[model samples]
Target: MKEELSLVIAFDATSDAFAAEDVFRQNGLSGRLIPLPESISAGCGLAWRAESNLEKELTDALKSIDITSAHIYYLIL
Candidate 1:
């Protein structure tokens, strides 16, 4: 799992996740909004998968766009 590092981002709600997806796409962020991974949790039901290294940039971008209710988790896939 150490070889597969990914950043899983969760939103407060489905709409928040979708809004983040739109912002990510508009800003050229490399990631995809997918159903929440079972390994993470069953709650929320949606998440964004991205490279661990891009976390800072993504976080800043999201914040600049006024994106709220996001939680980032670094994990090995």
Candidate 2:
């Protein structure tokens, strides 16, 4: 079976990650806040997980909140 893939958006700050979650919720994007996965080691302790195909929508939403420096990763989840 193929592994499912998802997008993980990590911020440099925990507050930013939480803020991004709020933005995603406000925009009606389906996602959740989770602990930063160990596979990726370059972000705050928190991350936002969402469908991989929603990159464009996520990017636009993050941009609206002036959060332009998040580390984005595509991972098998």
Candidate 3:
């Protein structure tokens, strides 16, 4: 299988992560909650994974919820 680049959104707090999940789901965005990758040294042990192409949409959705501490990264997963 070919590796693909995905967008990882990490949060400083678990509540923020779950809150973001709700916002994403409500907006009909595509992504899921995942354990924070070992390579990443941030967040509350949970992260959100989504297609890189959804960065803009994700950002907009996040803004609606006042979520501004998310760290975004592009990596093969």
TM-score ranking, best first: 3, 2, 1
Give all candidates' CA lDDT scores: 0.84, 0.91, 0.91
RMSD, each candidate, Å? Answer: 2.3, 2.2, 1.8
In candidate 1, the residue pairs with backbone N, CA or C atoms under 3 Å apart (3 or more residues apart, or in different chains) clash, namely none
Candidate 2, residues 31-67, lDDT tens digits: the string is 9988899899844399898999999999999999999
- In candidate 3, stretches whose alpha carbon ends up further than 4 angstroms from where it belongs are 42-44
Clashing pairs in 2: none
What tens-digit string does per-residue lDDT give for candidate 3 at 1-77?
A: 88899999988889999999999999999999999987787443999999999999998998999999899988899
Model 1 misplacement above 4 A? 1-3
TM-score of 2: 0.90
TM-score of 3: 0.91
Q: Where does model 2 exceed 4 Å of error?
A: 1-3, 42-44
Looking at candidate 1, the ten consecutive residues that score lowest on lDDT are 35-44
TM-score of each: 0.83, 0.90, 0.91
Q: Residue 65 deviation, candidate 1, in Å?
A: 2.8
